[model samples]
Target: MKMGWRELIRMKQRFTLMAIVTTLIVLLILMISGLADGLAYDNGAVVRNLPVEHVALSQDAEGQLTRSFLEQTDQPAGTEALGVQSMVLEKQNGTKDDVTVFASPVDTVYGPKELATLKPGQVLVDTQYAKQSGTAVGDTITDFRTKATFEIVGTVSDGRYSHAPVLWTTLETWKAWQDKMKTNYVSAFISQDPIKTDLATYTQQQIVEQVPGYAAEQNSFQMMRIALVLIGSLILTAFFYILTMQKMKQLGILKAIGIRTRTIGQGLVLQVFLLTTVSFAISLLLIWTIGQLLPGDLPFRFEWTTSFGYGGLIVLTAMLGGLIPLRALKKLEPADAMGGMTG
Candidate 1:
């Protein structure tokens, strides 16, 4: 609408190039952010859903639940061991299914359900698994460990962990199976200690940090996203700089004719803002679209907060990037106009 915007459109090729580059950079950042979100969900959502806020695993290892141990003597008075395991179950439908076996002393977690009669060979399976396996209550499932068979007593809703349907096993049954398997590991224990444990107790975030490659993988994504931000801003600055510098004569003429430096600065900044907005919009759309195309089990979780945060970062980077051009435009000399006029 103003002379500044009019001038920006005059260099169609340069403006188009800047917009295209920004679009690509923004798209890349959005995609990476989506993947990062997915990884975070995959890392700990189901475990995190368990009511307790802190976790206790073997001080000896991290990540693999099979490596943790909770001695009865060392169960940390107020702490609860959330015993979990992998077991193969044979359904009445005559299909073999792999399930994560969960054994807890009480239903303090997973929406809180206390089974009055938890004994050997009585178990529960998640609704998702039951749906997939087409099994109903009173259906007996054989445990591959010690070949200890279990009868499906109840259907826990939406209980899943590490891509497997969860099954409820009695703590006693779990102990017996652990003895049979020779692993004797009870995935991880939870503590409601206004206190710490004799073993290493990790806060929720600390536990997430221990997930294999989560930190490194996140760092890699962050670095790439940051670089994309910088590059987009730098490109905007360089293009505006070149255009403004080359048009020093024109600026001088406009200044001599009473044009304000502020007006010229607006032109450069608006151009940057316009291109950046378009790039960011394209990127946001691309991320959502691509995420939709991903398989359900691919572990991509695009929370609104994360998506909005990344988009805001992209916009801020684009805005900050134009500061250099603002300075360069501000310092322009009217004298350069005469030099151009003379040439």
Candidate 2:
């Protein structure tokens, strides 16, 4: 390990080049992972943040809440009926923003610290929507089509659906807003327990996957992340393998002089660990800085646990790549190495 440290220090340019590559790849992976999480949240935050585990949808709805049109009779036994409506919220200035209204028992929808059980005409808006529309507590926002108004009681963090902001209100208010088809607006039935109804049931994750464009978006990001990790691993392996070939005679001389192959292998892996550690540190700083500079409306999020988890995976793969050259090291003929050195 000491020898490897000295070698790395001596060959600054070579190690620095490798570190740069690792850093770039780590940055790409982190960015893609963040985007995946952000888009997933944007597409399904309403379902993801609900304090329920199971959702019972109408048989013909195919697990999609938006397509589910239910009567009170369709609600599963012992579950709360939750309705979702996508519409536009119009500001006094005629500016309009897309909003998905969630109508359920006030206690069922998660809200910010300021929120309590909302009154009949009061509603909780998504923080993103509050920011976008400049709507705050006590402000009344009008529904575009119906011109029905709701007073903002508070804001809910990460409350969105299908890329639109979400507003939470009592089922009574939502029911009053529907002048036609008053009996068929229930979108889904939610419960923490497994639903016992005849309707098709889905878990929270399954419901999120059913959101339009959500599954496909996540799959694409996942594939890109996997590809980047693989490419980083392969590059590490190829670089270290070439490095080992260049140092073959030197390694053989050390082996002949009593150096254990295990110790040599450990040294190489230690180098990989050190390299990845530095690269991860740099990548993390870059990611955080970029995240800070990004527009607030852009769906980007960075979490310590997720970033560190990816870093750990990169380090593990890099160490494994470092070990690939050990086979050649173990099979080297000391005499042949020396003869080639002499030649």
Candidate 3:
């Protein structure tokens, strides 16, 4: 460690540049990861909060909740039928915003949050919606489709769907807004017990993927993450390779003075490890600081577990980068290294 510190001190300018580059790459990766998770949560928090293990959709709907429709007669006994629709909520100021309306039996297992019996004409909205629209409990919001108005009775946390806030209402209220024929049908079935039926069943994860744009958005972010990892590794490897080459004559002099190749290799690995560790720490601090300054509405979610996991990967890649030069050093003769021939 002492030798590694000495070496870095001697080449402060070059190592500092490498550290800055590494810090930027790591920051980009962590920011991308947070955005990906935030988008996923924004799109699927409602489904993720469901108490059921699986949801049953109509076979002909092909796993799409919006297309699936189950009549009262088709619903299995004891299963909770849920109605979902994309609708607009008209603010008192005449502005409107899109929201996903969810109609479930009050006090049922499928309800995302625990609440008292919900009366007809009253609705519970996600906290995000309440804040965004500046609507409070006892306020009224108009439905753009049916021109029906609902009184906000309460607010629930983490209630979202398809990147929109969820509006929860009683099944009766949902029926009142729908045509008579469609009123009898529900979008899906939720149950804590295992369902035995001909309808297709999907786990929560599969249902999340069924949300519009969910799959595509996640795939793009994943590709970006993979590319960033490759770029960071390549950059670190090249930097270490060039640095090692420049110090070959110094290494040869040390070897002539009886320094073991193993000791020199260990020192190089230690240096890389220290640089990567410092860069990662700096990146993490920057991410946290920026996250604090971001607007509340911005979709950025940070998880310490993810940060630690990626930090470990960065360390591993940095060590691997040092190994490339270590391999060349092992094959070098003291005389050849002193001659400074580029290989």
On lDDT, the leading prediction is: 3
Best by TM-score: 3
Weakest ten-residue segment in model 3 by summed lDDT: 108-117
TM-score for every candidate vs. truth?
A: 0.74, 0.84, 0.90
CA lDDT scores, all candidates in order: 0.69, 0.83, 0.84
Per-residue lDDT tens digits of candidate 2, residues 298-341? 88888788889888888899889888899989999787777754
Report the C-alpha lDDT of model 1 over 1-343, residue by residue, as the tens digit: 2775786678778777777777777777777778777776665555656666677777786745545666655666666666766677776666777777778764444333744465676777776567666788888887764677788888866446555677876677778777777756566667655436666667766665665556787788789877876776676667666766787777777777888888776776777677777777777787888888987657676666777777777777667766676675676667765674432
Compose the digit string of candidate 3's lDDT tens values, residues 1-343: 6688898998899889989999999999999988998898888889888887878898887666788888867777668888888888897779898999888876667785443467778888899778877889998889886788888888988568888889888788888777633456789987877777778988878888889889999999989988888888888888899989988888887887898889999899998899999999999999888888888778898878888788779778878977999888888788887785444
Which of candidates 2 and 3 reaches a greater lDDT? 3
**After aligning candidate 2 to the native by TM-score, how far in Å is the CA of 340 from where it should be?**
3.0
C-alpha lDDT of residue 113 in model 3: 49
Off by over 4 Å in 3: 9-14, 112-117, 180-183, 340-343
Worst 10 residues of 1 by lDDT: 107-116
Q: Rank the candidates by TM-score, best first.
A: 3, 2, 1
Error of 2 at 317 (Å): 2.3
